[model samples]
Target: MAFKEFNCPSCGALLKLEYRFTETVICPFCQQSSHWTGENFEAKGEKVILADYGSKFSVGLQASFWGTKLGERKEYKFKVLGRVRFEYNDGFWDEWLLRVEGYEQNEYWLQEDEGEFFLFKKFDNLPSVNEYSELEVGMYVDWEDYKMFISEKAKAQISGGEGELPFRVIPGEQCDFVDGILLKEAIPVSIEYLPDNKKAFYVTIFNLDINDFVFTEKKQENVY
Candidate 1:
């Protein structure tokens, strides 16, 4: 079986175009319609290609420690939740510790250039952590209440509003901490295969405006 990539116009979800007879497929994330163009389907749009995991990191299974103080520096302690092999640079590499947090767990599609990552999710009723257990990788997630985390310094930089800034203003999103922007579209995905023979999970997302999406690696901390 072969799979082609297709992006959802409403929710920006990445879908695998498999069934040619399936003219319309609803996006799992946003519940949006992804209609197929009968004629010149190949020219309709472009497909997104992902990268392979390399040999840089080792994969294992363990628990992770997360800490968060409303107005202070956040800290993270990853305790090997599980191990998974990531295909990178044509070869496979193992990631020993995978951190799982509400916000940090969202899944994102990475581009070949490693420059951007796309966040994909539906805006319907999002699931709780317990509910998240049933989700699989490459599946749709609801992004309605997802929040973004930023550092104190980042927040201060925005408040001062005195010097030149590097990031653009995101609409309808709140600024938390000192240096972070919050969005409600973050969703988690299940991670397959670990050293302990257990399963781990992470979050992924898709970008709407930008051609590419990138996730800023943040310290994993407990939300509440």
Candidate 2:
């Protein structure tokens, strides 16, 4: 995909497309939401400009790390393309969209909350459930022959976002979520329940070491 630039419809502030799959963009200049239609930005509602809380990650930042998958470790590089903040009872967490180099699936999510980090990749085969009301903490789910136990069930509201995101972020939208842990492998599982009964599943890495990542100021070449 080629890199593209366009002006924000709300304020005419210049913005560039950081990833190929962007569906929503938050203008840094005007702090408003815009929908991307492959060619142009359509102005939408206003979005909050998240205050700097001294986070180590930011949109457009690049890093390389030794990431582990299925007990195999390999070096990988990725860029921070966007972020969405979710507010729950405990406070909030930032979910970052990353474009990882050399991965079969280029996009992944890195979640940070209260100084703890987790890396997650989109997972198919959502658990059998009609709604969030059916799930409770400690409920057992038999998924792919693995016995998983629900660890958390909560509702979180979308607070704000930055840069380019794969999905549209509607501020103040409520999201119901169920989190489980695969007992045998000790892997985490997450399911986000959206409006219209749409759901998203993710395979998570719990407590990923912060030291494994190395951030850089320079942009990676050939990202396009």
Candidate 3:
């Protein structure tokens, strides 16, 4: 049988109409439960709770990082572009899709949970210097292999601890960027400073339970 396509009237989320005989389908994008009868479909506007699906990060959320190391500590910044849920032997894993504005043209995914952050294993290509040069403040930079870039302003804040940093300097607090994206609050559990205060900054990922986390949806104005 031929398949059909439908758009959500409430959120405009794409819905795939899979069968001529099938009369009902759930939207994979938005959690809104919908029913299809004949040529026209009705949006119930009821929230459907999935067994495994939960909160998800939107595309416009700004990616921010904190450094515990001293002396030109790298601070990699990026924006979330997509998110996917994966089920494995252990449990469910939420993979955040990121796009590095100036470093890489393609998208990368990162596992969002406690413990160690998992790298995107889908891509074979790496970021380049040319891409870095194109980066602007508030642009999304995935935390892949590229280390965080500590701005001179941030360095001054760390040295003196007197002035406020451009981004959130505190352990937790949602920070705003020029692009209108909001970043989640995170604290560095550990930091390793480099010698001469100008080389490297190693930081341990924040340990937090996934159940306690909340996801922010993408604003309608930001959708393209």
In terms of TM-score, which candidate is strongest? 2
Tell me each candidate's TM-score: 0.21, 0.87, 0.32
lDDT of each: 0.30, 0.79, 0.36
* Runs of candidate 1 exceeding 4 Å displacement: 1-56, 59-71, 86-96, 99-142, 146-224
Clashing pairs in 3: 74-148, 75-148, 75-149, 76-148, 77-141, 78-140, 78-141, 79-140, 102-131
- Superposition error at 75 for model 2 (Å): 1.5
Give the candidate order by descending TM-score. Answer: 2, 3, 1
At residue 130, what lDDT does model 3 achieve? 17
Q: List the residue pairs that clash in candidate 2.
A: none
Report how far off residue 176 is in candidate 1 (Å): 31
Which ranges of candidate 2 are over 4 A from the true structure?
A: 37-39, 124-130, 205-207, 218-224
Q: Can you tell me which runs of candidate 3 are displaced by over 4 Å?
A: 1-59, 66-72, 124-224
Q: What are the per-model numbers of colliding residue pairs?
A: 53, 0, 9
Report RMSD (Å) for each prediction in the order shown: 19.4, 4.9, 19.6
lDDT of 1 by residue, 3-104 (tens): 456666766666664322334344445534333555412211122122323322122222222233354433333322222223323333232323333443
